[model samples]
Target: EGLEELSKHCFDYAVIDEVHHAQAPSYRKVLARLNASFVLGLTATPERTDGVDAVALFDDILAWQATIGDGINEGSLVPFHYVGLKDDVDFQQIPWRNGHFDIAVLEQRVENSARMAKLWMAWRMHFGSRTIVFCCSQRHALFTRNWLRDRGVKAAAVFAGTGSDPRGESLRALVSGKLDAICAVDLFNEGVDLPDVDRVVMLRPTESKIVFLQQLGRGLRAAENKSRLIIIDFIGTPAIRTSDHSSPLIARRRMQ
Candidate 1:
C-alpha cells in the first residue's frame, strides 16, 4: 500500500537497503511501478536464495564494491579465528520450509540440555573475553544466559520485545569486562555497533548469506587490544542446511 502510494510521485533516485531483495516478487512489483530516474541499491552481500544474481536487477553497471576479505587485509576490519565445533543436533530433524528451517522446532531442539552443554563446552574450550551469541529465539538466548551464569560465566540475553538491551543495563558491561557474553536474537544483527566484541557465537542456523555476514560484522569492528575476532560456529553433521552454500567451516577452515 505504501509503495503503491509512493509510486505516484517520481523521484530522481531511489535508495534501497538490503538491495538483494529486489528480485523478490514484492520488490519486483514495487520497482516495476516506480518511475524513478535512477536507482541506487546497497547491500553487503548481493547473492539471493533463488540462485539469481542481484546485480542484474541493478543494470549490471560497475559501482563501488568492497569485499569482506578486502576490509580484513586493509586492517579496517579485524581478522578472525573461526572455530567450527561439531554440534550433535541432526540437521534433517528440523522441518524445512521456504528455504529455511522452522524456527519453533529448531529452537526446541537447540535448547535441549545436551545441545546447550555442547555449545557451552565449545565456548569454554575457546574462551573469548567478550562474545556475542546469536540465538534462534528469545527463550534460547535467556536459557543460554542463565546456563552460562550458573557456570559462573557472566552473561545476559537481550531481544526486541523486551527492548533496549534485555536487562535494562548497558551493553557497555561487555567492554568493562563485567559481562563475558551477550546472548541475543536479532537485536545486534544490524544498525548497532559493538566495537569491543572480540568474539561471535553463531548458535542459529541461517540460510541468508547476507544475514550471516551481518551478524559476523558485530565482532569485526576494530578496537584497542583487539587484534582478531574469534568466531565459534556450531557445525552439525551430514549437512549445515544453509541455502546453496557450503558449511561455514569449509569456507573458513583455512583461516585457522
Candidate 2:
C-alpha cells in the first residue's frame, strides 16, 4: 500500500525514521521507487544488522554528528554511572539466528526464577527512584512488573499493541511519582523520551551496537533535579565470544 502510494505521485521531501533500516530489501525497494525532490534520513545509528553501513544510501555524508559523550560534556545530556553485572544464564548454549539470539529460547532463559532473583538483587543494590527495566519479551516484562509489585514496588509493563490510552496512563503515573519503575519490552528503545528517568536497567543482552546505544540513550536525556543517570547492564556470555565487550564509556569523565 505504501509503495503504491509512493508510486502515484512525487513529493517535495521524503523523511525516513529509523533510517538505518534503509538497507533492508523492502526499504531499498521503496526508496528506489520514491520520486522526491529531497530525501532526509533520521537515525542515531546508521549501521545495519548485516554490518553494512546504511549511510551509503544517503550519499555517505553526515549532516551533523553528536555522540552521547559529547552531549554529556556539553551539558545537554545527563552524566552517568555505569555498573556491569554478569548474567548467570549461559546464553552460549542457546540457539542463534541471524544477528540476534533465538527469541523463544532467550525468553525461557530470562524467565528463570533463580536468574530473575539475581536481577532483582542487583536492582535492590543499585536502586533508583525512577527506573526502566528493558526485558527481552513481553512475557518477561510482565513477569518482572508483577514481581516488583508483589514486593510492594509500584510498577507497570508497556509495549506495542497495549493501546495508547493505557500506555499513556502508565507513563503519566511514572512521571507523577506514582510508579517506581516500568518494565518494558521494545517500546522504550527509541523515539520515546522520559526526561526524569534517572536509571536504566538492561535485562537483555544487546544484539547490535546500534540498539545498545539507543537503549542507553533513554536515560541520558537531561532533566531538572537529575544530577546523573545510573546504567545497569546485564552482561550475557555469547557462544563464540569469550572476551568481547561493548562499553558506553567513550572519553567521558567516569562517575564514581
Candidate 3:
C-alpha cells in the first residue's frame, strides 16, 4: 500500500538502499511502477548469490567500488584477525544440488559430537566478549547454543520461528553483555548492525562470497574499544571455494 501510494508521485530522483534485493519480485514490481528521472541504487554487495545483476537495474553503471581491504586501510572498518581451523567432516559424501549442499544431510553431518567438542575447545582458546556463531540450520544453532550453555556459557539460539526468545531480545542480551554469544542460522547474515561483536565463528560451509562478506561485515563495524575483529573459520576438506580478486582474504580462503 505504501509503495503503491508512493508510485503515484513522479520524482526527479530516487535512491534505493540495499539494492542487492532489487531483483526480488516485489521490488521489481514496485520499481517498474516508480516514475523517477534518475534512479540510484546503492549496495555494498553488488554480486548476489541468486545470479541477478543488481547493477543492471541502474543501467549497468557502476559509480564506485570498494573492497574490504580498502575499508580496513581507510579506517572506516576494523581490521580482522583470521584463524582457519580444519574440520573433519567429509563434505564429499554429502550430495550437492542447486549450487549448495543438501541441507538435511549437511545438518546431520554437522551435528556430530566430536565436531562440536572440537569447536568448543577452539571457542575456549579464542574467547571473546561478544560472539556470533553461524550455523548451517536451526537445529545446528540450537545444538551449539545448548552445548555452550551446558558448559556454563551464556548463549542463545536465534532463527526464524524460534520459540524461546525473540530476535530483538536475544540481540539486546548480547549487546548488554548478558549473553556471551549467539548461535544463529540465516538471521544475522545481513541487514543487522552488531558493532560490538568481537568474534565470529563460522560453523558452516559458505559457498557464496556475498554471504561470506555479509557475515564478515557484521563484525567489521567500527566500535568503541574494538581494535580488531576475530574470525574463527572452520574449513571442511571438500568445501566449495568462492573467489574475489579484490579481496585477498576471500580469494585466498575461497570463502565464497
Candidate 4:
C-alpha cells in the first residue's frame, strides 16, 4: 500500500537527498516519475568517478562547496586533528573509499578490539563532557556502550536495534545531559539535531560531500561556545579529491 500510494501521488516539490546516488537505476527511475516544477538536490559528492552527472538534471546548479580542508584553511571552519586509522588496521585488507562503509570489517574492528576502544578513551579524556562518536556499524554501537561503561564514562549508544521506544529514550537522555557521548550508525546524521555534540569521532568516512557536511554539521551547532567542533578523523587521508572536477558555482552564505 505504501508503494501504491506513493506511486499515485504526484509530487509537486521533489527533494532528492544524496542526489549523487541518483545515477543508480533505482534512484534515477524515481526521479523520472516525479512531476515537479522545482527539483532540489542535496549531495556532498556530486561528482561520480565517471565525472559530474548532475549537470543534466538541473537547469542550473544553485550552489556548491569546498572540502573540509578548504574550509579549515580558509578559516571558515575549525581545524581538525586527523588521527591515524590505528596501528592494528591493515590498509591492504580493507576496500577504502570516500562514500561507503565496510560494515563487516568495521563492526569487528570497533567491537572486539582495543584500537577503537583506546581511541574512545583518549577522546573521552580530552572532550568527555559533550561528545558524539559516529560508529560504522550496529555491533560497534553495542560494543561502544559496554566499553564506555567499563571505563566509568557516562556513555550511551542509540541505533535502530534499540527498538523504537528505547531509541527515543536514549536520544532524550543525550539531549538532557544524561549521557556524555553517543554512538550510532545512522541516527546522528543530517537533520537529526543534537546541538550539544561538540566532539565528533568519525569511525566512518564517506566520499559524499553531503554525508561529511551532515556529520560535521552535528557538532557545528551552537554549544556553549565550544572550542570549535573537535573532529577526530579516524580514517587516514582526505577520503577523496573533490577539487579536481568541481566547477565555479558559489553560495550566498556568509562564512564569518
Name the best candidate (by lDDT).
3
State the lDDT of candidate 2 residue by residue for 133-242, as single tens digits. Answer: 88877777888888888888899888776422267888899899999888887788787879989999888877666667778788888998998888877666752211
Ranking according to lDDT, highest score first: 3, 2, 1, 4
Winner on lDDT between 1 and 3 is: 3
Q: Which residue runs of candidate 4 sit more than 4 Å off their true CA positions?
A: 1-18, 24-30, 47-52, 63-86, 94-113, 162-165, 204-214, 222-224, 235-256
lDDT of 4 by residue, 8-107 (tens): 7776687888777777887777766666767788865566545657656776566565664565456645544333344355434565545344567655
Candidate 2 stretches greater than 4 Å from native: 1-15, 25-37, 161-165, 239-256
- Name the lDDT value of residue 178 in candidate 3: 97
Lowest summed-lDDT stretch of 10 residues in model 3?
247-256
Each model's lDDT comes to: 0.77, 0.77, 0.83, 0.61
Query: What lDDT is reached at residue 33 by model 4?
Result: 62
Give the TM-score of each candidate.
0.76, 0.81, 0.91, 0.66
Model 3: per-residue lDDT, tens digit, 30-127? 89889999888888788778899899988889888877788878887888877677788888899998988999999999888888877777778776
Query: How much does each candidate deviate from the true structure in C-alpha RMSD?
Result: 4.2, 4.0, 2.8, 6.7
**Model 2, TM vs. native:** 0.81
The weakest ten consecutive residues by lDDT in model 1 span: 247-256
RMSD of 2: 4.0
The clash number for model 3 is 3
